[model samples]
Target chain A: MAESKWTPKEPMVSAKDVHKSFGDLEVLKGVSMDVMKGDCVCVIGPSGSGKSTYIRCINALNPIDSGSIEVEGQEVNDPHLDKLELRKKVGMVFQQYNLFPHKTALENIMMAPMRVLKEPKDEVETRARELIKKVRLEGKEDSFPGELSGGQQQRVAIARSLAMRPDVMLFDEVTAALDPETVKEVLVTIRDLAEEGMTCILVTHEMGFAREVANHIYFTDRGVIVEHGPPKTFFTKAKDPRTKEFLSQIL
Target chain B: MSARTLIPGITARATTDLPVLKPFKGKPYGHDEIGFSRFLANLSPWAVVCVVMLLALWPMAAMAQAKYTIGDAFDALWKWVPFLVTKGFALNILISVTTMAIGTAAGVLLGLWQISPHPAIQKTAWAVTQAFRNSPWLVLLFIVMLAFPFEITIAGVTIPIPDWMKAVFGLSLPIMANISEVVRGAIQSVPTGQWEASESLAFSRNQTLWRIILPQCFKRMIPPWMNWYAILTMATPLVSLLGVEEIVTLSRQAMEGENNHPELLIPFYGFCLVIFFAYCYPIARWTISLERKFSVKL
Candidate 1:
């Protein structure tokens, strides 16, 4: 039994009639979705399904052609301010773990906060150390990205994202590139963030994570969200037949 | 009879005379001629090294009298070391730095200009860089000094401005080509993902550059930059032809003129060679160290 709760009633971020096209490929077609405050949405779909593309557009990584997105009470089309201010509040973690190769793990985490956020050194060091420890990258602060394993690098990337003190963290298949042994550690970190009530929109194939950690689940296909609901109801009994077919392949 | 008719007879004679020829082996596999050719080719590179070394060093060895021991050579060299360290070395270093600075700034601009969306700008920059690259450095120097103003003009101004500026232009002419190619390749080498990532951070096309593109481009670009610097250091001697009172000219004038005369021209040109070595070697070493440093981690 589906709840009769209307979606737009408690939206924190909203995209209305969004559209984007890359060359001749119309990736996002009038797609509109809203996320409530502190919501953990896991977007699951096949490759080229545009779930990753949608999450990227949430941060304006890809500008929409025709629609408007409002984030944290700011309209998408409004200009005149530096957007680093907006970006500081929205952090993104990449699939390939794009840590600065030149910097140590500690410096990688500390750099943005010190340079961008203008945090003092003592506080930066303290926070960076704590975050590194949280990601189980303890005692490896001085190591460069090349020195670390793939799992460790991804964890450092997560810590690097968290250092910005973001209001929302976008994880685009954050563990997809890691070995099976390493993926569990990164998943644990995301799970910890979810349990702590941090807002996260994750695009992942880890159905277990989508089941366990997602407060809300959105199933997208060919750039449109076909259905979305709480994890227990949606993953267990999705309303859309496409969503059912996707789950059948994965589960 | 010829051996053709007497083959069996000769064989029978040899076999009758020698017991070893009685039992022949099954087959022979490898050739000594191939092995000899391989052996010669292996030594060819080392032979080349020795020839070049003797060619370069034999002149000094001949000019070097018994009085000219390594110690005397060192003393003659060392006597001018400070004069070089201050004036001659400084001039050589200054030339390299200035050309490199001009070349890099101009190269980056021209590289972007060459790739500009505007066809006229891109074509112009490409044509100019190609001309700079193809023009021989010494020949270009002579032409720019002697014939350019007479042959070429732009807008309302004549081409040749002044002698000193001519020298600077000549030195930097080829450098523009080198730098244009370097920076163009470097910027292209960076993946589109880097630009996309910066844009994702809400940096505008321009903001993305300062925050991301140039930093990565320049850092990865250090090797070519250092190589240009070294070549520029060695090229300081070319300014002698431009009548720039640079080190090579100063040393040459010191040797030819009567004043401050040594026993022979050896002290003058010999001292100059030492100066070239002293000034250029450390910087070359520093450039190598820089390469090692930059390549170490990232």
Candidate 2:
């Protein structure tokens, strides 16, 4: 609350006293956090705990009822904020790979850059191919989402977000829908992104994966950060009983 | 599921006379007899039905010698075909095409308005679509015919409103309503996830609607759009009641030109039916195929 003790550099994403509700049901209850530059923050919690809702609120995908969310000094919670400009910096991939079914894998990655950013065609196409290869989908550039396997589609979705050259990336249980064998490929892609210093926030059930790739872990429960620490400390020596209980059940 | 053998060699090992393979051989018994039975098996059901219908109508064909000879009917057709094409048919097409263009443009706006976040816009769109959609097409046609000004003066110049233009305006109301429903249904059919993904990409509401949402809706909207067009085309004859010189009116005039010949009455009306069928049947087939091809999997 005083300052983000975690970061020496400026925070890329900061949420302060965020409160959100759907009708009478309040989802994010005074939730706050700081994701510094290059931080891979993994959010883990039970299903209805508002983990996904919190990350969505960061980019104004879901508006906060009260509080402030700032990304790169831009007030995301401001009503008059240029949301399109804000969103260009914060790329998100969904649990179900929401790849545009109408576009090919390359076009899916290329469209936002070309249309939204008004980037040059050749430049966008070249970058899209690079992102495709980064996500380990080199030859699948021309395949439709329906033609690809679940993992391949998810990887393409990741590449699509990366194509925007976003300052921060959000993954909402991206590999949750994949088969067990296919999960590794998607995780590997995310790990590669993290390794290359792309700031990421992941809401995941994969504790082992979170432990492996995440720099910091935020244990959320009932719309609050119940526990937060480095993954090694958080997974091994979580001080809160709720965090321990959640970890015990999951691990 | 049974584990079917994938290898052709394995299938061949089971039997020498494989039915699936037998179709490929030109001479099954080492004889060059491509029989009539095999030829008949290859024919489509539609082709067969046409042949059978001609066979059944042979007696009727022979009976046409009585009052109006086939030659006389052909003569009537020869005289009327060019007249219908040059005058009445062109108007029918103009009416259909103009109504379609205006209806579709307004319908898309109305449909998008139905989903507008603003409550007043939504309510107005709902009322407009429901009002037109619920009314009888003929009643609406009559109402437009009577309600619109017969002539208008813009500045000092007076422009007369043609009866055909009135019919087009009337037809467009119902067409617009139906198209609004089609557009609304198509947009609603898209999964919620698409909206979330597009929104997260920071696309403005207009960008999301026009670029992301509308493109996806095209596949769902097209079949019904074609279906509505065919129905609209067929209903163009209803304009004759408003005294528009469409096909039916032309047919009546052509009949009267021959002294209202009772003998030629069947042929003249039947000619209208054939023309309508010729235009509509292909559209019906095309709409069905489009429905099959672009049936939304999501």
Candidate 3:
């Protein structure tokens, strides 16, 4: 196994012995991982491998049954933890855009900032417009999500998450739902964020994007991290038989 | 479609400025310069209304000679309608508005309670709402009307609860119960992704409901709400059984006035039908329009 190049300083997110189950089906079996500041970690695995569940646990979106997760010194697994407050520090983007159908692209980006942050409308509008432009949805600001294409809507979703100025972003198959031609735009937007040093944890099937954007590659299966290392070695020199098997099918 | 047509300033700047058209640059049309076609278009709405009214009243006119003339029935209507407006119709409006206000507020609370995180609270609210919803409106009204006293002592002082108040309370109980179902349905109709997206944004449960979920629900609830309101309005006539002197009571009194001719009975009842259709038709149309406007895919 190749060692991680970046040494841990102030870990942005740390999950220890995290386990989650859906009734009798145990999805997460004592999975553990750490995401440090500015680390672009890509989580990869097969279907029902708990890849999505593990990342969701980091933000306490999926409540862990055992073990703990801490993000920016906030104990996410605490019984009294303020989920709303914890979520503000971590922005999440899903495979489905989930943009408010009623709201315009600009409004979708502006909503959380104005309502949750209680920021001034003018300030939020300025940042939201900037983010919309950043997402390459400049002229489409007034358009509603229903009017936009899949790629455009996904970009708006990214901009909406970025509008909160989150410290860490969790992307769960952000581009998985996109059409082939439109997928590039969303990947490029995420690549821009990763290059900007935004601490991101992504569960994705795009091996090429993962190799390019993610510094650390974690191979997860049946709810645990079976192997993790630098992308160069993890892809080319994976030690585990399972990682090799998973990579073989995908790559 | 061109910008020049929309903003006449462009035309004014483009051509030699005419004093006649310059003053009306921003207005829809210039005064005393009406186009014949545009004037016809403007009058179309009033013409349509007149045609419909004529068609509606024609049936009464054709049946006029058979009994009391339609003219006499209308004259009687003119007299009794004003009397009913001040005495009976006003009460209907009051009962309807009051019931809607009180019922909607109580319903929202009960509906939210039904979905409360606590299992006990949820089940309790569910049971109470279900009980109220399952009971017939008239039966429920009768029970309240018969069970409660006219006055109740509170802090050594008696507060009078009049018959109308009893009727209002009775009407509101079922309204509240039905509205609760509407509220529950509307909330449930919102997709789970909306909740997840809003929650992931760090919005509190209340915030998510009020800002994200409820706004979307408001659209889904409107058509059903308006339908319920129309039903409630028609049911207000039932309060006449409790001697409330509402529209139905006044209609009976009006019919009794012309008992000698008795043939006027159909016209009197027809008047009530017209009143109800006049009130409900627009509401139904408006609800449909709003449904189309606010339709969400997910």
Candidate 3 stretches with Cα past 4 Å from truth are: A1-10, A239-241, B1-86, B148-161, B255-267, B296-298
* Cα lDDT for residue A232, candidate 3: 91
Ranking by lDDT: 2, 3, 1
* Complex DockQ per candidate: 0.18, 0.50, 0.44
* Residue range with the least summed lDDT across 10 consecutive positions in model 2 chain A: A1-10
TM-score of the second chain for every model: 0.63, 0.75, 0.71
- Residue pairs that clash (backbone atoms under 3 angstroms), model 1: none
Candidate 3 docks at the CAPRI level of acceptable
lDDT (CA) per prediction = 0.72, 0.83, 0.82
Task: Kindly indicate the candidate among 2 and 3 with the higher TM-score.
Answer: 2
Report the candidate with higher DockQ, 1 versus 2: 2
Worst 10 residues of 2 chain B by lDDT: B29-38
Q: Of models 1 and 2, which has the larger TM-score? A: 2
Per-candidate interface C-alpha RMSD?
A: 2.9, 1.2, 1.3
Docking class of 1: incorrect
Q: What CA RMSD would candidate 1 show?
A: 14.1
Residue B271 displacement (Å), model 3: 4.0
